[model samples]
Target: MSQEPDRLFAQPLAQVADFVFNEDVARVFPDMIKRSVPGYPTIVENISVLAARFAQPHTTLYDLGCSLGAVTQALRRHVRADGCRVIAVDNSAAMVERCSEYLHSQDSMFQELLPVEVIEADILALAFQPTSLVALNFTLQFIAIERRPELLARIRQALLPGGALILSEKLRFEDAIEDELLTALHLDFKRANGYSELEIAQKRSAIEKVMLPDSLQTHRQRLLDAGFSQVLPWFQCLNFASLIALP
Candidate 1:
C-alpha cells in the first residue's frame, strides 16, 4: 500500500496535545511507525511465524490494538489451522475503518485466507473467546499502568492450554545509565530514518504523556502474576522487545 510521509510533527506547535489515533494519524500511521520504530517489519512478519506454532484448531487469534491490521494480515497469510479465525480490535474508529479496508483488500487478493473480524471497541472491556494466540503489538504501553495487570489476567483466562500471548513494547531499562544510552540510540535511529530534530522532539512530547513503558523485569513479573506458565523474551532491538507468555 502506498503511504503518505508522516509530517504531523514537522512544524512547531505552541502547545502539543497527547497523541491520538484519529483520522490524521490513521492516514499516516503506516509511514509513521515504519520510520519511528526499529525492527517493526521484522516483528510483524515474525508474529506470523509464532502464530503458526501456537495456533490451535477451532480457536481464535486476537490482535489487540490492531492498527491497520498489519499483524492480522500476517496471521491470515500464515496460519492454516482448521476452523481458526482472527479478531482484530482497536478503539480508534479511524483505525478500525482503515483496517477493515485493508483486510478486505487482502481478502480479494488471497484465496481462502483465514476469516477475520475487525472490531472498533476498547480491548479492556471486550470479552475474549477461546484463543490460541493473542498479540499486543506495541499496544500495552498505551494502556493505563494500573489496568494492565487485569487485562493480562483476562487474556490468560481466555487462552486455551498451550496458548501464547505475544507482547511487543518499548522497554524502560531499570538502570538509569542503560536507559539513557538505549533512549539516545532510539532517538538516533529516528534521526537516521530521516526525522528532523524538531519532528523528533515534538513527537516525543506528544507521546510521552500517553505511552508509558515498563522494564523487562516488570513485564516478566506481571506476566507470571497473570497466570502465564512462562515468560520468554524472543526479540529485542535497542529499547524495544517482544515476549512470549505461555498459558
Candidate 2:
C-alpha cells in the first residue's frame, strides 16, 4: 500500500527476478529504468488515459509481465472498487510466487477492499477471454522480434470488438548520434545509482542477445498488421512510448 522504497524496496532480489534473477540487478532495476528511459512518467500518466477510453462497470484487465505488480497496483485506483478484476500474468515463477504471497500478506482491510489475481503464464502462448483489457507495459521488447506479430494477433482475437490494448516499449532510435546520446545518459544514470561503468557494460553485454528494440514506425506498422484499427501513440518520452491500439 505504501509507495515509498522502505516498503516496495524491501522485496528480496530472488523474489523480484524470480530464482534465476540477480538480487543486486533486481534491486537496481527501478532506478535503472527511470534513469535509462525518458518520459517514464508518461507511461504512468497514459494509464489514466487508457483507462478512461475502455473503462466499464467491471472490466477484466490483463497485465502482461506484471513485474511485482507495481503498475498493476497503480491502475487499481482508477478502476471502480467493485467492478474491476486484474489478472496479472508473468512468466517468472519466482516473481509471481512472491507477488502472490505479498498480496496475501497485505492488510486485511486492503484485502477486503481490492480485487487482484496474480498468475504465472507465458504471454506469447496465452488464451484471452472475450472481454478483457490487455496491457503489455515495457515488456514487449523482451519478446523475440519474430514472435511479436503472432502474439499481438492472438491478443487481438481474444478481445471483444471494442476491447483496448495499451502497450509501452523502449524503442530504438533511427539516428546513430541520438542512440549514442541516449545510451550515454542511461549509462551515466546507472553509474550514479551505484553501478560501476564496467558492471553496466557487462550487464548490457549479457542482455544484448535478448533485448530487441524496434523503432516507433516499426511498432505502429506491427500493430496495424496485427489487425488493430487505430494504433496511436498518446505519449512519447525519448525512446519510451505508450501506445493505445483498438481491435
Candidate 3:
C-alpha cells in the first residue's frame, strides 16, 4: 500500500470537477480515506467481526467498490467459514490493479487466507453470485440515487438465507439545525485530521456534485422496500453511519 499523503485538493483549481477514483486518487486513497472519514478504521475492523458472525458455510462473500481491498483483507483475516471465498469488485481500473497487488502481498505473509478474485467492473452491471455477506462500505453514496433501490434489490435477491448486507454511508439530516451542526462538526474533524482550509473547501467542492447522501429514515425505508426483513443500525459517528440489513 502506498504511504503517500493526500494532496490532491491542496492546490486551487479554476473549476473543481466532480471527484473520480482515478490513478491519482488511487495512489493516495489510503491516506485520503483515513483522514477524510471519521471512524473509518473502526468501521473497517468491525466489518470483519460482523462477517464472522454472519458468514455461511460454502457461500461467497462480496466486497463491492473494494478500493485497495481493505474490507476484503479484513474478511480474509477473520472469516473462518468452510468453503468460503471472497469476490472484490471495483469500477476503477487503477484501484483494481492496485488492490490485486495488495491482496497478493497479503497472500505471501498469511497462510490459508480465503481465496479472492478482484475484478474491474461496474458493480451496477455486475452479476452477483449467491453470497452470505455483502459489504458496501461507503460505496452506495457514489451511485446515482434513482438506481440505488434497484441495486439493493438485486443484492437482496442474490443473498442466501441467513445472509446480511453491511452498508456504510455519509448521511444527510432532515432537520436544518441538525444538518448544519453535523456538517460543521465534520469540517472540524477534517481540520483535526490535518487538512487545511483550502484542501477542505476544494475537496468539498469536488465531492458535493457526485456524492449524494440520504437521511437515515430514507435508507431504512429503501432497504425494507428492497426486500430486507430488518435494517439495524450498528455504528454512527458524527454524520456517518453503518447499517446491517438482514434477509
Candidate 3 at residue 15, lDDT? 90
Per lDDT, the best of the predicted structures is 3
Q: Arrange candidates by lDDT, highest first: which order?
A: 3, 1, 2
Q: Write the per-residue lDDT of candidate 1 for residues 60-156, one digit (tens) a residue.
A: 9999999999999999999988999999999999999999999999989999899999999999999899899999999999999999999999999
The TM-score measured for candidate 2 stands at: 0.80
How does model 3 score by TM-score? 0.99
Please, what are the lDDT tens digits per residue for candidate 3 over residues 68-151? 999999999899999899999999999999999999999999998999999999999988999999999999999999999999
Every candidate's lDDT: 0.96, 0.69, 0.96
Minimal lDDT window, size 10, model 3: 9-18
Each candidate's number of clashing pairs is: 0, 1, 0
- Model 2 over residues 109-205: C-alpha lDDT tens digits? 3544347888788888777765457888888988889999999998888777666899998777788898888767766655665565555555565
User: Which pairs clash inside model 1?
Assistant: none
Better candidate number, 2 or 3, judged by lDDT: 3
